[model samples]
Target: MESLLLSHSAFIPSQNKEVGYLGRKLQSSFYGNMVSNNFALRSNINSANRSVMISSVFGIGRKVKKVKKETVIPEPDYRIPIVLLGWSGGLIYADNLAAAVPIGLLGLLLLVQTTRVRFVFDDEALEVKVGEQLEESGENVFVGGKNRWKYSSFVNWELWWPNFPILVYFKETQTRPEGQVHFFPVIFNGKQLYDVMVERCGPSKTSAPKES
Candidate 1:
């Protein structure tokens, strides 16, 4: 078997001074009705941006304190995640005959959320330190087994809304998440990175698992 070294890193979006202001406006608008009476709404945007910026700049990770063990597998899946940004909302009406009203005014809020995708190798797992804001606050490391997508850890799983990305409800026992990771606007996408990861970790397993 051939041995290869892989790194756990994410592509950070380019820094923009306008991002902070733009984010605040959009988030305030979405929860306009929900948080109309709440004065602390503005603070939410600043806090969210602060966390999101740090995560994106550094990528979802922590220091590699030590290498417990490393091994290379035969196959790996290399799907590049696309980062969506610049959130916007639109209004629409949903008609339900079963409900009290035949035509109800429904504000269909369309928002763009930012994210980054990095390929994880079968033998490659990351030891991450999550902030107290997240469920797994302590120092944690996820190990990759024969299945690459079956990871043991994830960070900052949040719901991307118009202005701010909100953290979804997480239980202490639930292992898998229903949301995606928060990322910065600075995105790094090159054919070289994609090809390298895919070549190193291509999926050819006979059976597909339930979770990734």
Candidate 2:
């Protein structure tokens, strides 16, 4: 589970807003999937009497650490937290609007360096987080258990991002309001996720026709 989530998270393509790119949108999709999964997992944890705690963020420029498992979730700060859960899960954090200014400014100076954000999936849920390593720190979102995304709930998973090896999409639809929402799983277990989707959810109608 750990290996699959980490590989999937690492595989997510980073988008640039400079060229009419959809980085933010893509990021949103990833986050949405994370949330959907986390919600389901958390529900299960509650029912099963197990709990997941997220620590607060710490550390200096370009890096952060979680103080404890139940730490207050990041609020407008790039300071991401480290997630611990009986060795089954991990967490990641991203810059909030308030902290984005400083963090983004610093990010500009480091051009050559690269980091891998780690994400995880357990029996009950999914998570996104940075590791202790300097380059491998970011954000963690949780989804799971009762509230998990069912194959039916997701309308689609699109591959709109270029340059990145993998892209996933999720959608929610309603009759009252005819609209479409897209979600990406920034971090996931590529083969496992793909296999599960294919098995449980199947593919969307609009997906690029599989090359035969």
Candidate 3:
């Protein structure tokens, strides 16, 4: 569950998808609070729009221990969060808002840097842009990487906490199984991305047009 609900959260994307950082921040902020369990998500989309509705958070940034003086991207502020949004699913194509902010002032305090988020859906894989501030502890570093996954490799999924967060785990593969997983959140409106997963996964493969 959310540590505390706040109405005044940062990271709101505009209608044209100009804003960035907020959605990714929200995902990272709520990621740790995730729990492991199985639960079904109800579909809220009607017949008129068969397209799936989801808020994809593409995270960008990596953790650097000691904050070395030399690096890429100049004068980066490890204080503010950055987020960018791109929405897509079936027949639905529109920019969407984010859900509740993670814990409390903690998110504000913890956001040393922000991530970039984008959403991609094709016949091969469901790609959502996701990078991390790269968890750092002055000594070790934890990178926020691997924001893409194949539905075929999808082993199972679980709802994080109270409302929209979801934890999707993948099976052990060539380079995966090193605890490879991604965290995604659903936008408000009584809908869940799990429904999209149920509808999009597996079928997208068979539905692909075959080459002659």
lDDT of 3 by residue, 57-149 (tens): 222233545642221121222222222111112112322222223332323433422233333444555554333442222311233435445
Q: Which tens-of-lDDT digit does each residue in 1-212 have in candidate 1?
A: 12222221111232343576678878878778567646577778888899999988887666657744443221211111111111111112233233312112111111111121222233444222122321222322242222123233432222222122222211121234553332322111223322322343332133211221
Model 2 scores a C-alpha lDDT of 0.40
Worst 10 residues of 1 by lDDT: 82-91
Q: What is the overall TM-score of model 2 with all chains considered together?
A: 0.28
Structural RMSD, model 1: 41.1
Model 3, residue 45: distance off in Å is 55
lDDT of 2 by residue, 152-208 (tens): 455555543323323466554431134345454323334444444444445756863
lDDT of each: 0.31, 0.40, 0.35
Winner by lDDT: 2
> What TM-score against the true fold does each predicted structure earn?
0.17, 0.28, 0.29
lDDT of 2 at 106: 42
TM-score for model 1?
0.17
